[model samples]
Target: MIACGEKRLSQKRKRPNILFAIADDQSFPYSSAYGTSGINTPAFDKVANAGVLFNQAFVAAPQCSPSRAAILTGRNIWELEEAGTHGSYFPKKFTVFTDLLEDVGFEIGYTGKPWGPGDYSKAGWTRNPVGPEFNRKKLTEVPADGIHKTDYFGNFVEFYNQKGNDDPFFFWFGCHEPHRVYEDGSGLKSGKLLTEVDVPDFLPDNKLIQSDIADYAVEIEWFDQHLGKMISFLEEQGELENTIIVVTADNGMPFPAAKANLMEYGTHVPLAICWPAKFKGKRITDDLVSLIDLAPTFLEIAEVENVPQMTGESLKDILFSDSQSKINAVREFVLTGRERHTHARPDNLGYPSRAIRTSDYLYVKNFKPERWPAGDPVPESAKQIIPAEGFKELWPGYQDIDPSPSKMHLLHEKDSLSRYFKLAFDKRPMEQLYDIKKDPACINNIANDSTYATIKKELRDLLESELKKQGDPRVLGFGEIFDSYPRTSKMREFKGFNKRGKYNPKFTQKDQQIIE
Candidate 1:
């Protein structure tokens, strides 16, 4: 909550500094502000308590690279050609808000991760779209296992020192923690009890799964720790109240059926914005919002004109409004989708799908229903092959879902956890409808249920119409165009790739050259 009397900055002051802190692979309701157990996020809670806490925030896509790309360009994934997919080139034609800000007077730079596992170099970009890199700072003593050694806050301080005396700064504090490769039992070792873990219904409610989640909490706390330090640094520099701070994640937590799926757990993420001198504090809004809206918001706040082609609307109305809940009644629905994530499927094919999420329901359309949602069941190379460099070793089968302890447990104990495994890795139908109020986990599909036939039809029509309007190639009868994008990451050989015969030399040869 805000203080009884808060100080406001002068209206004639220089442009507001933008400190955007984004966590990797974090899900909604995972912070202490949401009353979630096991994880402690004082930094996130402080921002939410001091500003606007969004209850229904979702990303443009479920995966990291594409989702970050959407946020940078303020456009839907389908609208961004190769940048729409993970581990692909970002076309040079796309204009990022950061570049626009830099063309003005803002001093821009980023620490930790910024806009890739993909190559912006191949896309003919000289620097990261977010800004210049400021990751030169490093920690002398590493804090914990699985936590990156990069000193995120220290880099921010370095960037601050390099800024001009009269120039406003925009820094991207991207944290690499909480993505994956967590140290086992790290949370338990950090004094968190297993009972504190609230296991999602989709996963087995057992000690192994609980511990895996606890370990995830450990990484999340690490990310928050750096954020708290950053906030304090800005305050110490007398720039806290003047900076427009936005805290959120690129996508949901990395887990089976979560990070890579279009389900609520995958697309929904935590969002909090604080500008004590501007936006009202201690407010929580449930209106559906997409991450793509953030780019335009930043541009509008910076007073940048001649904006690029973008699909997202600016959040100035909702942000500056005094009303807490439903500031913009017209902002009812948000759309999310995904293409390729990892080199899992045959010929690097992706599970393409899109969804329309409203307050009460989520309707998804799986364009390639014949393909596996997670990945193919068999690998053409070997039953036990190590993944590419810097990536965790993925066990054979269901490679779209990252390698994790929960994944291993389910696969090893498939007989007992068959239902859960199917929910995570099995093929899905062409259309799926879920009542969010009743089924938050999305375990039951009611697409074919006659009782909700009208709702399903209405949702389908709305989803298709909106997607078509957005110029999504999937609905425009050339959905195969998505498969043509070259993946810059490692390629996997699945068992039936040759038999399926979907591979095309026009794209595959170019992709092979990039990969090699």
Candidate 2:
């Protein structure tokens, strides 16, 4: 807790461990490191204070499945075929870095979520997606209460203390927090008094929104605190010095704009790395980094050679050296995309959007621009019933929702608020470009503007070149690429997170409807 003093020299360095801590629904807004929000995250603060915090860190996709898929594999989401979007379907052919690392003598293990929305066992995989289970305590600890799962952190320590000492670890500490359906007002419990939670100016500044943000901050803190404890554990175990500690979110915060969209709030994540043995490069780097590069980063650091085909560059050079004068940044831009989320909306729709995010702007070319961006509108049958409100089914648990009064108010107004919140969740913009510096919210698109024509064209070109390099199906035609790829049973099944069937996945079962 004392002001970070200079780290004096240590004795012989051991091959460092890699501690990858990923949080769910986390946005770049809160981390004190970003200096944007007023939310206090001392744990993340400590990491940023000690290490290099990437201001423009992004995942390959907005939603969890593809994002995680990209991280596990060193390729872009599209290159992985059916794993193109969340829980869509991932072909079993792709090779994951976890399996690769394990093959190379590193002990890999994880708890909590792994490559999701698909059948893990059927994927031709031997162990759990993360390899060797880490959540044993949860089998008995998590109550019969179907609403919750076991605490991932508690189970991790129990597993690691027993299994990790033998070899260097590539442990993935995944936290499913701040994601959804938390106990309201949970953030208020941990001495985090949110008299004022810094919220984005785009959202309505009512207590409802602020309280929503406060609850989110609390969950983020919960994840951060657990990670802080884990860090303490590492320090106790003498692994802190060499371990590459990366604290980040899978994608962005799960608000209207963040989770599913390719906007800054969605793809722009908070990444801070603290590797005591790496380097003392104290300043923040604006060089763009994608989660896809994670495999190469790990491979480079561990000195593994001739890995699978990779589009990602290693951060080894960036992390270990002081080449501030070099022109070789990670990449000029990072590409992001999505295959599906909710089911197709009214026109029986589905969305397939592709975008390229740069340091200055975000250019997205919506392939299915004609379809609703937010799946189809709520089912026509549900249209008669008024929309339900009160945080829309998925409210945070940290808030002090005096349900008696609050529920009454929410019940009567749920319909209106539901419809209100539904706006952002509804549609599409064809060719969109936002100057992140000026409009961080991505509310405005200057794609058609004459003055910004050159910037747009440049960005557009960058996107096309990158997509072509990555071999996106969209270039050959969305339907053609998708049809050519042939989705597996899992990716074909659409029953999105929204189970109402409003946007039921337009899934064509493997044998039932062959694309050829």
Candidate 3:
């Protein structure tokens, strides 16, 4: 009787390890698993094949810092005051899943980029919110110019070595690839044919754009390469099946109109979660999901009691269920918004906007519709010159959009490609709606069309109602509070900025301290 009781106790389920791999600035449908041409992502495809491939996964915000913050806190960007904007301070008051896991006997560490371009120390945290660093590994040389030399797999090995034999672990592998400022011809240099790349409708379909896209593919491949190596290492260690592998991107591609804007290419990102020991494999789910759900999902798996007040719901049911269809029916839509991205607008303002995306439609509400959706025009208010040397002048406005070869092409050939340029950098209406089933590119705005008036109003009402429920200051008539949040990034000199009468002296001053 005693032997039988001991055997029963020993058979209790062991907690699983977690491997969360996130790519920086990658779009949905860009991975080879999604049948996107030119880019090859075997590691991402492997994970998807092993578990479930989420067909509709979106981030809470399109920008990097806020999007990452949302993922870390299991809350919407608007709910996270300072952390909601790019390069703002992270308040330590909000609980993170990593910290919770660490307290519960899990060894947590992260390699490469974590929640950043922002300061967590200002919030009084001892280390990065993700975990302690495992970024000491460095590569002697990189395949391309723009790629980071941080050996992500080597660092993971370092983190793994430090863990106790019986300890369950959580690792964050953040890849800072597929972002911007790529080597001009690295794609061709990598033997990728230009014909393999397909330019999106929003951009001009020419050699320049196709080559740019191909270059972007190269970086994505680099990110996938490291992920493959990590997976192989785990398999060799006989720990592959017991680990929950979560692969996704922080936001979207760093193209002219994709990264910062609340379009399909902006918030929509690739997601694949795998856990062979528990969840069934080869299931592709088409349900709409958000990255904000990640924190709650992690906490649920860890079995941590006293979960905080998080806005996002857990995906445990969807993961455990074998159904390919919607397991959680309440997740009918996901909300995305932006407060500030870069110091682009006058007075260091941001283009405040909120949007809600469903499976069939995307509705946007631009609170400050008159403001430029991209950024202010080039040639600073103080001076104006075409920059005799070239089109690649430093700080050549539209600062919201990252500086890229595609952006320079649009600016230079604005006359010939006026439609594309305007689409990339233009003021939008107060309300915009797109039938995503028909126009996935979001080129046609049917919000004003009488035929779809009823659907438009329904979406608009739903969006505002949800935002209000989340206590979003934008919808609460306290929208200006976001602008007052101190921006920790480099301030750009734009029209009406730093002017005596126009702007506040405190905001204009350089190196403003965190407002506790």
Candidate 4:
């Protein structure tokens, strides 16, 4: 007795609802689901147990703005122009997957952080690129320090209430957890013992560092808690079976040599996806997946076409298939890179670098080896004379690395802990190579050693070939254009860099054609 239009609407409603939950600045192997002991992530574990847990998920860029941009557009970071760089304007020409979904009659909304630390308003968009906002709710008391007090669960309830009964909704649950400025000893206060934390080989083993990691674990737990609530809400609404839930992070944890660097911990992120109606559950795949793959995957799942510009491959087949061996064989490697992360360098220049990670080895090409890898060697506070201690002088300009207890310990004990400090803050060679299986921390570089010469060349050639195919400006000899792009963020003054506020004259409007 229903009308034809009503029947079509009902058919659309049968399509899956997408609930994408992203944690800010969380790395892989931090969740209990991954056997990382310090943190208990019941929500992440539930998704993994109920669906597919991707062991090798990576972000296109190590920094937030660019990484989120790549995930939204399904393209390489360099192809995005201003959006490719950190804290820059989002050019309106590049289409975001959310806008495409919205145009196709999908009711999309997001709570908390959504695609920015940058200016999207300049692109003429009325709201965040993710979708319309639903973050008016507030929490009376947050569970821990360094956690945003946004009532994410309450906001999701409000979002669901506003949804039409027949609408297939796409909701972005972006949690601003595990970023920075943690309350010292908050994790220990929460009953998490320091002994439970596993310190990476790159960092010195000390109580301060352990406690800092514990605090980071606490924030991740906060994100997981919100995820649990949202999942419960979906189940209560009877939308759990048909809904596709993806749990992941924007980038790695905020720490020295992790967040901004192109190391393993920097780009590698945790991922779990579930949809009971379409895919088999309780599967684990070691397929190499880039966050960019999610945009195309979502579009395909929704059956919305017209994504010719998307360079990322859709993982729909892999997700829906019950064959674990077949899914793992699809992707062999993943590419990740970075441009401007922060205005830490002279003239706000970024440490432009490209990297390729295969099953066994990781190869990195630092385009500007002359520049300091972390940041400038001088501290922002020290204007005139360089401090007598080399470590003290470098403290202010190591802004590329986040300030943390680990970094502080390394700096304070630099007299005896010089090796650790050098591993994190020193300058580097043009080419770097590491056997990630043996050296996951990426502390040892064997690019020049004759033993790894073959692997170094092979990885370098593969990385260059892929970059050229993608038309990356960095590989196309206009890499300086990335440095030339106008940064919309607040500019900081660095000594000897007179062009702090000015764009590079070498770059011209015609240079943008390279990206097109």
Candidate 5:
């Protein structure tokens, strides 16, 4: 018979550890756990089966830096000022949750990609906003085509070992998978069949596109494989049950009309959380959740005081509740937006956009509709703006769109495949709306349609009101300040000249012949 003292000791609870595993540029419906067939993600599946799988999880923004900033601060993109735009500085005033966790005796560390593509030091941050780095470990056998070969599993083991057995910890495993610049034929080499690839409607169905997607699958598998190893390590240490494991991605798949766009694929991310000590397993919820909610959720779980600046609500109620029904009916809509994605445009201006997504509809407001939606049509060559010779050379006009087989195909067949090309790269209207249920691809614009006018107005009003309440500078009539923010990355030169030796026109006007 167990002693009373031993039983009391066994029943004692410790603060929950946090394991945040975020994939770079991965989208929902890509992981096999989410019913995607081409990719296999046993790790994500394990977490889903062991806890709650969120069918509708979204990021605050569609770009990397801003999306991650929102996840770290639990605030909207526009609220972040310089940090709100891509490749800009992270201001120190915006205290990250990790810093808060670290102050309260949490052993926090991160490996691989944390908060980046921007300078954190410029903001006087001593370390990366996520946490101190732990990427010294290396991998032996990794795909040559993949991005970083940081031994994420090994580094995590090191981090775990450094923490005492009784210490509560927070580890960020940011995998740089499935981003881009994939090795050609890596997927085929890995035995990923082309037929198994599920191509999105926006892109043409062809061998080249299939192969590209297969390569993406290979990278995603790599991320999952590492995650499985980490889970195994946690289970071995008997820390699995008490740990809060959150698996998701920063944004959507890196492709044309995705990634940087506030479209369905761009913002909708796969999410699964496991905390065996507090919640029942095998439950699925359609409750709309924002990635920003994660910051407050972590603070609440740790019994830490939430910062007043955090606008996102905690998901603790939804996560801990036994019921499978919608945890909060108020969580019906999620807001996602985007600023500069890359220094692809002239003067490093970003195509500012904001969007609101409900169960049935998606409403997007392109603030600078006259500007090239994708990117400047002509490449700012060596700081010299060039004239368009022919459509062939200038196929992928919008430099914001990542160079891919599908992108090239669209560019090559833009004349013949006008509709598809337009859907991916053409200039968009000021207001765009889509009935997501009928058109998940977001190809159909119903903003001007008489049938959706009511829905559009409702969503638009809600989105703008929220922006105002949040003090978004864009809506506060200081929107031009976002364009004026200095880009930390190398500036692409295109602001100096036009064909007639006239100073290059600001990209906001629709009359700019360079873009037209």
Candidate 6:
């Protein structure tokens, strides 16, 4: 849904101030513009109206660190070396988008989360992980309210107001919301009614799910409120129609079949771009766009001639066509994968999986499908966040093990579901393919069914071909290659907080390995 002549427009005018916004745990379900899910997102809706709404947008990785890293560096996880997954050990080789833009005379800075593990002082960073090695403004400044952090937008307003808006600016504001550690009914408390909510089939249809969804919506709306304020600030500064605004998230919600999985719920996210005075408004297109493609699009827009060694194609064709009838899609296909989720198990227990999603179906190849699809099945005491520091105690727990009969009885009633829960939580299979039309919730597995043999074969070939393009060491026959990748952080292991007292899982890698 890109506007026509984006490149031509870029070649003619001064570079627009880029305002890139990212939200945490946001999916397509939350945006009213998408209409697939029920949620009121006016701020997002406004942007979609003013610019292009990509109906099908995918993230490079599902988890926070890797996905955000991919977006910032314009490279895939494997290409980023040690910083390939969540809590990963990053090395000095990779450079982020902000760094490159700043080098080309743009004033760049990002607020909120950037997702690189150790900012330069830590093991893996060579340059300042986010931007230039040091802040040119003030390094040792503190706010009067005991909050020493400099806000992203407030700083931008200050910088441009003093400079008379002559210099181009690049600002990244990442939001930390809708990711849980949630207080149930907080949405209700904030005047949001659970009765008005619509529960997706993937979640159990009950008061619990409704309330949870409302709480999530509340957080997302709050994030939107912040984004709205940023937009307002731009208008007051007389830079409203000049800034190229991109609104999206890091990944999907933290839940079963999502967050860490290769499912659509894991990799699919909401993407909207708004640039007034640049394009037509109130248009939505079904072009499949990868978040990875934005890097190249940004490079092309800024007239930054060189392209990094990235796997994505620039979205030049998706935008304005000299021919009115030739409407090419933003992307032909999208790719996503994951290496590891948590440290609950050792041998660096990884649910190494890859996926290929077209407009219709999603195909996945699980290399270490022998590992738990959800998490390791251990004692009730094993499912708690023990040594949580600051705000990192928000990871999803072993939810399948909840002893309450409301869910427990329901779990027992469905034989395959019960086993699948154990399997989803414990380990997985080598191959998986889902017919999105019949099973949007993805509760059924038709990978080995004789009736779906053709579907399976087609998916297998697609998976192998894409993996080959990326030079995946697995299909080349080194299935255990991922195990050699270092587990940089043990954030999920020693820390857990559940119904029981302070629980610390002191298990070894060998103890948690799934039996093949």
Model 6 regions lying over 4 Å from their true place:
1-13, 36-38, 117-128, 132-164, 321-330, 379-426, 479-481, 491-516
Writing each residue's lDDT as its tens digit, candidate 6 over 317-391 gives: 654322222246545567888876665443345667888887767878877666566655443453354323432
Candidate 6 has what TM-score? 0.80
Q: On residues 203-309, what C-alpha lDDT tens digit does candidate 1 reach at each position? A: 98899999999999888888899999999988988999989999999998888989999998999999999987888889999888999999999999888889987
- If ranked by TM-score, best first, what sequence of candidates would result? 4, 3, 1, 5, 2, 6
lDDT of 4 by residue, 1-516 (tens): 999998889778867899999998999988898899888999999998888998889999998889999999999898888888887767778899998888777889999899988878767778888889998999989877667889999998899898887888999999989888788899999999898897888887789889999999999999999999999988888999999999999999888778988988899999999997878988888778899999999998888877757878888877987867437575778899998877777666789999999878889999999888788866535646555343352445677887787777877788788988888888889999989889988989989899988889989999999999999988898788888766666665554333433455556446353221
Residue-level lDDT for 89 in candidate 5: 75
Tell me how many residue pairs clash in candidate 2: 22
Off by over 4 Å in 5: 1-13, 379-396, 496-516
Total backbone clashes of candidate 5, pairs 3 or more residues apart or in separate chains: 0
Question: Number of the top candidate by TM-score?
Answer: 4
Better of 3 and 6 by TM-score: 3
| Cand. 4 Cα-lDDT | 0.84
Please provide, for model 3 over 350-377, each residue's C-alpha lDDT reduced to its tens digit, 9 standing for 90 to 100: 8999999998999999999998988877
Query: What Cα-based lDDT does every candidate model obtain?
Result: 0.85, 0.65, 0.87, 0.84, 0.83, 0.64
Model 5 alpha-carbon miss at residue 490, Å: 3.0
Model 5 TM-score relative to the real fold: 0.91
Q: Indicate the TM-score of model 2.
A: 0.82
Model 1 residue 329 distance off true place after TM-score fit, in angstroms: 0.8
In terms of lDDT, model 5 sits at 0.83
Clashes of each: 0, 22, 0, 1, 0, 15
Q: What would the TM-scores of all predictions be?
A: 0.92, 0.82, 0.94, 0.94, 0.91, 0.80
lDDT score at residue 193, model 6, on the 0-100 scale: 70
Residue 500 local lDDT, model 6: 17
The candidate with the higher lDDT, 3 or 4, is 3
Model 6 / residue 41 / CA error / Å: 1.8
